[model samples]
Target: MELFNQIFVDPFVTMYELPDLLLQTLWEGFVSGTLYSLIALGFVLIFKASSVFNFAQGIMVVFAALTLVGLHELGVPAYLALLLTLGVMYLLAFSVERLVLRHMVNQPDIILFMTTIGLTFILIGAGELVFGGEPKAMITEELGLPTGSSDWDVFGGIVIFQHIDIAAAVIAFLLILGLAIFFNKTRIGRALRAVADDHQAALSVGISLNQIWVIVWFAAGIVALATGIMWAAKSDVSFALQVVALKALPVLVLGGFTSIPGAIVGGLIIGFSEKLFDLYWGVPILGGGTESWFAFIVALLFLLYRPEGLFGEKHIERI
Candidate 1:
């Protein structure tokens, strides 16, 4: 007990003597939570529009990253590469709207989900063919983003922060803000809501279902690109990063497919709780590696209590 206390338990209990580490951990959790919310937003958008869960959003993240880097490798300027990447996403949106989705509009949700899974494979193979399977550096400083770290002395300990992390948090918050407005305060947004409510009824009206799909998919692509950039800044840009995107699943489960604010709040809750529990409990009491499934276990246990989710509409049987 004494050896365990000295090795694992005491390090965190002595956090008071290490206020900076505590502050740093909190900041990192917040940043991770924000990024998770962004990924969740992509899922929510397509789900609301078409009533199909877009399982391919993770690959979209990798696709966007590959697009950006592949363009740069071909002698395009960094800024131009970003612009061209957005154009590629836009073209993809249009093509899918005109091609695959137009044919599959009335398909079952399960079928649509499987289609997305297939699309994931397509994107993975295409990205690999275009960019090769290598981890590439993000053009952060080239994009004039902040770099290095800033430190503050708090209680005789330095609370250090990555400038890139701060930038990512700010950019993600702004992106969410923009999406909130687009969804809540626009004519097209109302049309989208109508489609979500009843696709056949929406078609009966003047709303162009195909156009709406393109817009929503392209919007999701933009978010994916942003996610790719921020994530690449932290790790390497690789197809393997799609695995990280899976973390957003528990976020959606805790949030609810239809609720945007729920995604954000749920992500923050999961993020902070995991960090706290893994640090204060898992490492000390258990033999670590708790992060692998900590969020899933919390989500599953919470789901037993509130199956419909905190923000999801209550499900009641109609007699």
Candidate 2:
């Protein structure tokens, strides 16, 4: 016990004693976690509608960011460039449905997953060729996002929070709300749910598979765009940003790949725990870089007890 205290427990106590920095770190983690959820939501939307895992969702984030910045670099207004980039994402949705989903309509899930993995390589090559492989500034000021920071005094300590982070958190919240409403309150949303429930049955009942695929992919595009903007504001837009997409795998595992609410809760859980662990234990024990792998490890441990996830549907298959 004494050895453990000397090595791990005492150091964490000293670190936690800094309430201001702890609060600030948690705030940052929460904001980042929300953005991760947005990206994961893209996977949820497409997976629900088409059962396609969309390995390209991460690169879609980078591609959207590049298109936005590229259009602005051509002298378009920031807002206009944003709108046009959205149009690009829609175009992608249209093309994907027409070219990929149409041909692979009745294919097995493994095949669809493979196709998406192939598509990811294609997107990576195309993005590098068209956008250049260098990291670019996100044009945060041009996008009209607030910058800088503010501080609040608590317990004689000042907690600093960034305005950009606050805006990102707010925007993520609104996006989640919009998606929730879209999934639960609208006609198209209902159609989406129906298709997810039974694709062959949906087609038999007169639902156009093409239209549903396009719409669901477009919704995913919207999610990709919002995630790109916030993440780009935080760090420069680059292929590196695509790696963050891997974070969504654990989020999906925790939230259930099919549940929107699951995505949100899972994202916050990963974000908070990773930050907490990194803050209190990473340095005193495992060096650092815990953020890179902590979420998956946590998810793996959780899976030992609940393989279906917190909100995933239970299986009732019987012979």
Candidate 3:
């Protein structure tokens, strides 16, 4: 009974007693979730259009940030470096389509997946070669991102909000909204959907697979850049950041492979649950570190009960 009380009852009691702390935790979770959704969005874009899991997306995020910082280190202006990075991402997209994906058309899904893993290694090696194996600071001030914090007084305590965290949340929300509009309201968006549904059928209807692949990959690249920037702002830019990006795997599993909204909802769920669990039940009972694996545990539960995910379509096979 004491263990049960400590496991469940005490956490709720804490929440009731420390409302301010609860709010702070929720806000932090929201910010983290927004970033996770951005990363998952990159995954969803490529998977929806190409039906191939892009395992390199995480490294792509690191690479994009490294490129931006590398250019700035060479004395390029901040905004100009940003533009150059976009151009670099575009070149990457074009080169990938022309060189790798174009040749692998109609290949088995496993082959395509392995190709992305290979791409991950190539990016890591190239990034180390070009940028060296050291962490770099993000140019937050140069990029016009906010700094410092504000405190909100409530429940006889204060909740502190970092200006950068607020900026990150706002920027992520805008990017998500813009992408949602672009995908839902554009002609290319319709074509991409058609291609996602059936490549051969889309080809018969005059959609160019090559063109769609380039566009989706490019879009994913843009997302990667944004994610890289936000995450780098929170910490130093390094190849190890890719491991953080791997957290998106659980996000994808919770959200569904092809769903944009599911990505958002699932990210928030993981974010809030992990933070709360780590602070409340985890530290008290399990000696902390729950945030690292909490999301995966939730993903495992989802896989067991609802493998299709919250928004994924269930394919009924007559076997």
Candidate 4:
């Protein structure tokens, strides 16, 4: 009975008593979740268009950020370096489409998946070589991102907000909104969707598979750059940031690999739940360090009931 109370009841009491702390925790989770959604959005963009699981997406995040910071350190102006980094990412996308996806056309899904894994290793090696395997500070101030924190008094307590966190959330929302509009309202978007549905059919209709692939990959690269910037602002830009990319796996599992909105929703669910549980329940019961596995555990339990994910299409088989 005592254990049960601590497990199920004590956390609620703590929350009720420490509402300010609860609010703070939720805000932290929201920022982390938004970042996760941004990464997952890149995955969804590539997966929806290509049917290939781009394991390299995570590395792409690290590479983009590293490129941005490295360029800045080399005396390139911040904004100009941002543009140059986008150009590099675009070149990378074009190269991948030309050299990788071009040859892998007509291959099995597993083959395409394996190709991405290869791409991951190549990017990792190239990143370490060029970036010297060191962590770099994000140019938040140079880029004019807000810093410091704001606090609000509520319920006789104070809730604090970081300016960077607010900026990140706003940037994420704008990026997502822009992507949503591009995919839903643009002609190229229509062509991309057509290709996603049936590559041969899209090709027969005069859509160049190579062109579509380049565009989709470039789009994903752009998303990666944005994610890398926001995330690196929160921490140092390091190769280890790839772990943040790995966190997207559970988000994809929870939200469905092909869903944009699902990515956002799933990210929030994972971010909020993981932090809340880690702070309130997991640490208390498991002696801390539960955030590491919380996402996968929650996703696994959810998947056992709905393997299709929260928004994935159901695959019904006829007997």
What TM-score does each of the candidates earn? 0.94, 0.96, 0.98, 0.98
List where candidate 4 sits over 4 angstroms from the true fold.
none
Q: Candidate 1 vs candidate 4: which has greater lDDT?
A: 4
Model 1 residue 132 distance off true place after TM-score fit, in angstroms: 1.0
Question: Where does the lowest 10-residue lDDT sum fall in candidate 3?
Answer: 175-184
Which runs in model 2 stand beyond 4 Å of their true positions?
A: 6-8
- Residue-by-residue lDDT tens digits, candidate 3, 1-319: 9889988799999999999999999999999999999999999999999989999999999999999999999999999999999999999999889989999998999999999999999999999999999999998889989989999999988999999999988988898888888888899988988988899999999999999999989999999999999999999899988987888888999999988898898888988889988999899999998988999999999999999889987879999
**Candidate 4: residue pairs that collide:** none
Candidate 4, residue 276: how far the Cα is off, in Å: 0.9
Q: How do the candidates rank by TM-score, highest first?
A: 3, 4, 2, 1
Please give the lDDT score for candidate 4.
0.92
Report the Cα lDDT for candidate 3: 0.92
On lDDT, the stronger of 2 and 3 is 3
lDDT of 1 by residue, 1-319 (tens): 8767856668667676778778877887899899989998888889889987898999999999889988887899999999999999999888878878889977899989998898889888988888889889888887888999988888878888889999999999999899988988999889888988889899999899998899999999999999999999998899888987888888888888877887888788788878867776777667778888998997897799877666766767999
Looking at candidate 2, what is the lDDT of residue 152?
A: 96
Worst 10 residues of 2 by lDDT: 6-15
Question: What is candidate 1's TM-score against the reference?
Answer: 0.94
Candidate 4 differs from the real structure by a C-alpha RMSD in angstroms, to one decimal, of 1.1
Candidate 4 per-residue lDDT over residues 206-287, each given as its tens digit? 9998988888899999999999999999899999998889899999999998888889999999989999999999978889
Per-residue lDDT value at 117 in model 3: 98
Cα lDDT for residue 259, model 3?
A: 87
lDDT of each: 0.86, 0.87, 0.92, 0.92
